[model samples]
Target: MRAPGKLVPVVLLVLALVGCTNMPPPPLVTTPPSKPPPTKPAKTSEVVIGVDGITGGYNPHTVADQSAVTTALGALLLPSVFRPAADGTPQMDRTLMRSATVTKYQPYTVTYELRGDASWSDGPPIAAEDFLYLWEQMRRAPGVIDSAGYRLIDNITARDAGKVVEVTFDKPYPGWRSLFNGLLPAHLLKDAPGGWDAALEDGFPATGGPFAVSRLDQERGEIQLERNERYWEQPAALEKVVFRRADQVGVVDALRRGNDQLALLRTDSVGLSLLGTLGNTVAVHTVPRSATATVLLRPVGEDMSDARVRRAISALLDRDALVATGTRGGPGSTLRAEAQVLSPTAPGYRPTRPGGVSSGQPELAQAEAALQQAGYTRGAGIWMRDGRPLSLVIAAPAERESYVSMARELQRQLVNAGIQAKVETPSADQLFTESLASVPTGQRTTGAVHLAVVPRPVGGDPATVLASNFGCLQGESAVAGAQPTNPVGFCDASVQPTIEAALSGAVPVAETLTTIEPVLWREALTVPLFQEADSLAVRPELTGVDVGRAPSGPFDTAVAWRRAPN
Candidate 1:
């Protein structure tokens, strides 16, 4: 989901002004090839950014169509009530919202006040109806992507003639801040026939943020955003921003050629060797992203269904070695050996490596012993039980090249320990979208996917990720049904109370996470591999660049960016 496109209305206005000019035309000017007429110094205030690619349609709610580009665009153009700070704390964007307060605890209720001056670029007030519309779509629309926290809200109503919003919940929700981060204009979406899909696709709507989409060229894979005149806050520092599509090599080339000032590249996308070559030409910043690469064992009918088997697999793999190999031993490469879902950098996070699991040092003997105790014998360099080999299939998303390398490494380690394992690299759509749902009771499992190497972003609230991924009553638990984030079908009734307690603000977050971390480790639901660091190349003069926990990249704080003294 990237930003949508149309020619800027301002372009026409400039043309009309030129046509009505009364001054005599100036004489043509020319310069020799050796000394070209001083090209009116390219706007120093604007920033040109290069991204991986423009793949999905520009709709974040359209689950399957969302992409990193879409999330980035939303940060720039959409109306967000709260924006995450560098430390992953929610900061109220006073331009869009005045305040949000919890007025009641039991049958939880919240009151929100929107800025009186905040209105969409098209002249509609940013009101409670917009929040209500987003909530209704997320709760009712089947195609909507992530509705975890939104579904908890019971109702929302307008007060003070649409200036204030009052929301009531059926149960306590501590992660309320995560909801309604990006709100669509109600006037445009509420009455649309196709609902959100139609509204999001019918040209990006006029926005209320610091910037608005001025042009989107799909063929050239570029999007241009101009400062929003209707913005209620201090104006954005840059007058215009252009996002261009580029691969790893292209990103480096664009930066070197002075065509782009900023670019984000994955370590795997551009090898460490290539990054090192840039040297003094560009400054590399290792931004600690919230996402972590993990290995999820399917809890359905397979040898991996047994906790012992899963734990044994966890013990055998050398996560440090995997990270080293996958990242090419880069400067920021390190293993996320903690069994918990929270990133080490996140608040309330604690290291919890399961007692027996060897992260950097492989415990092949212990792994084999566990397999033997489970009624398996080594034969022909593979474990066999009752004339059947202990075979498993690991699925990796093809788009993430590092995951592919890690999957192969995992397969090799398993085979070395007398286990038959195979790695299958599938398209991102197939691995993330198609294979996320649980297999029906009487239906055949798709591809018999035994394990999946996936990445989950642990945003500002670690509790949100914990609840969304591991809670018994939510996510992809057998009881809660399947969701894309929780396809492993991990369910423990005992952990539900703690999860609910933490989410409802009844228990201390650290205490709840401390209680739940052990459960995840004991069940071997997921093997935390590493916290992926977002790599960015920027000109030395650029200032106020910050990579927050959101998936929107560094542009999450684009409004604050400026050029430093040269």
Candidate 2:
């Protein structure tokens, strides 16, 4: 495995929280209410979700660690603007948005209205200017951080009071609506010290969510999230949503040992299997996270340096077989075989074939032909570069037993197909460093880091991976902030203009994807992998925890869910 962000992350906050819109405040708590107005009572479920490790840090705009504090903390802050609805979808939550109207296009602008009851946990109105301040702060942020990712937008404009906010992009970027999840406490930070990443550790300001910062325990385990009765929307479900910090591995353990009820995070299956073994009393919801997994493919030995050869190797991959092994737990595992950089469940995914690959049939003839066209000849047992054996290292998820097996099989398969292959196993940290070092090619860097493989992030948004990893991007890209998406080291003379156009907010998602296909096909960076099936194991006793295939993604409506009777 590789380390996280060895190539400098693209503005760290890739996982910022998106706030809810148009929610009617809780029914006024008057004396026994007015003459029996029949109403459904608010839900009350207190199930703790566990994080696997001690959070490295918790600054949304800048913190280095990816703790729950950071992920859940954004609820306290707010995304610059809430998009009301996700990309290419109808607004499902009408109660949350004051109004969903795209006032203008040509200049690429959208505005949202705040409900009159919209107020922070501290009872302050959530002004539209708060978003404006956030935009300005992001534009002017210094040092290296993720907020810069949005700052790269030269044409964004958020004007007006706490009710009206607008943004303008230089050109049409179809995914603009998806980026509406930036958060800011404009009134509090209007004249604060440091940016979001540098907020005072001892004391953070008021937030607009159901929970306020009641106890800031920087040295302890988590930020205890007491439900804010003053929040504008329906009050949060749990009285206390303890944003507990633990290791990813520990998450499963915490849940099974009865230490916690539910958990979310990339975790090992070891601890989870124990729950099943112990059987039913405790419910374990094993949902496949819509997160990306990168497999390492080293370019050492093989002439995979030739884009065609790499593309050819990408073709013969048996994604179904791969998934069978890796996600063998099936419904028991949350891993899915994705079709592109985005998950199969992601929106805008129009699969051309069963899983999007061209004739997944292992074509020995085709592989030979492609290599021949690239100026290479088949030698004794394997393909060669210059009288030397052609081989490269492939890194994968070693935490799973299947990873080791896959690494061995990958080496064997590549060899059988005429390219010599080897496996160079590395820890997660090493994996990141090695993958980054190998992609530029003949940086000879990792010496043998080759095929970094796995299902991509399935957030239904390409930016999930695009905003964070652009490995194929060479030299400077017009898309600033962080660019780790290009793993095949795809370099285009016109990549800058292309990315800019796609992100300009004017193009529709379908149109933008149409534009990116040919370019990606030419680069051979991310060849279409297979569709993934997430494994999930939920004890029947725990009700309301919904996990379904979504037009936008997996596990979408778990928002207002709850655990059944104990």
Candidate 3:
């Protein structure tokens, strides 16, 4: 009976619990949903720059291929032992070199210690072989740029498993810092199909700088560079860089439309004025280039064989008018050249002309006298010498409007002076390789023209420039290939000793220039008109567009360029 009562209480408890569960759950309780975390905007990492043109031969060491685009590419893709500082002096690149110091006095030894991590984009170590290759090529190559310092190198020794380089000079070279710039990748270029002449003609085989060539199209005039993943230094700020060829109007339009972020162009006064139209959207600056506008009278030509006739032509030239034509009243107009050996804007440049010859005005009376002295008689508005008409052909690069304009002006001036002359516009490559380069020994190729309005490369080592311009090819038995030296085909044996002295560092550069400039001018072979200038125009969204150094301009610090948020 007691068990039955307990079971009844248990059954009642169970029934009460079941009844509570059966009733609807008391008021569903929940917290409000939170808003999703706000997303952030992506940062920009690409930049597009406008350039005048894109010629595929990108070797910075060659006279024929030396241009703004070449310099820019070299700064982005090549490595150098020393780079130019803002003061225009050699400063060792800390990213590539740990230390570079003079170790010996007697043999004049210089020891360079490369950073252990420094390497080419393709994973090859930047070692002594690269230095050796550049030295061998520069000292021996016919058309290389500024090989004087390389020639002084007697031998190179490698140590520390190729991480250390020891250079032994035959004599003390104070300008040794100028050597080994834009070091090429020996592993790829040494045995390439075309050798030094054809090396980098298409694009770099390997890159040693912060950026590498991702795309290079010659016909389309576009070269795209991307951040080099193998670079050991700080990564470049921009992920992609594109060099696009465009004219002045196109560049202005692109900048306005945000298609281009920056532009480096060979500009005239009208070009500057057009840039001014952009107002606060862009900033423009004048960047002095390493070349000077010049007029060269090829003595190998029949009409210009006599120095007197050359002098007569020189006397008739209106340099001011030519400068105005070439510069188009731009900043270069203020850089009128006053010397044969150095550009007026170059450091230590001094006028070498006699006092009376300081003014660059047409001396019509002197021109007539010189023509008469040369036994040239005027007949039917043309000079005739030895029963031959004194006619000439003036040449200029077709791509360069300034050069073509200057050539046309010169032709008009010569025609007005009773000297029959015609203008010829040719491609820069053809003009440099065939018309300007020295022909091989025992073989002759008559150039298309006798007079050339060209850009003479300067602002390098004075000795190297002198040798490149006027010195005879010493020790070389024959001109086996195209030699971009002595373009006028005129050399004086008497000045050979002085040139050697300068190249050997025996005579100071200033003294050497002083001694030889007058002789060069008296020869009447070449006349420097003005220093050339390139303008860098930058859009507001693009930052870090500055003249990094004296020679290379903005490309020297291209790794620091960036695109800012609008």
Cα lDDT, model 2, residue 8:
45
**Model 2 C-alpha lDDT per residue in residues 44-145, reported as the tens digit of each score:** 365465654334334444312222335445534342243224443434233335664557767655567666676666667776666566667644443112
lDDT of 1: 0.72
Between prediction 1 and prediction 3, which has the larger TM-score?
Answer: 3
The residue-by-residue lDDT of candidate 1 on 72-151, one tens digit each, is: 77888888877786666887777778899888877698889988998998998988888888898776454344455776
Instruction: Return the top candidate by lDDT.
Output: 3
| Ordered list by TM-score, greatest first | 3, 1, 2
Relative to the unseen true structure, what is the C-alpha lDDT of residue 231 in candidate 2, on a scale of 0 to 100? 64
Give me the displacement of residue 178 in model 2, in angstroms. 0.6
Clashes per prediction? 2, 73, 0
lDDT of 3 by residue, 178-287 (tens): 78889999999999887887889889999999999999998998999999999999999999999999888898889887788888888777788888999998888888
Q: What lDDT would candidate 3 get against the real structure? A: 0.82
Each prediction's TM-score versus the true structure: 0.82, 0.61, 0.84
> Which residue ranges in model 1 land beyond 4 Å of their true spot?
1-36, 57-68, 136-148, 185-206, 268-281, 330-332, 335-337, 422-426, 439-446, 474-485, 547-553, 563-566
Cα RMSD (Å) between model 3 and the true structure?
9.5
What TM-score should be assigned to candidate 2? 0.61
Error of 3 at 226 (Å): 1.2
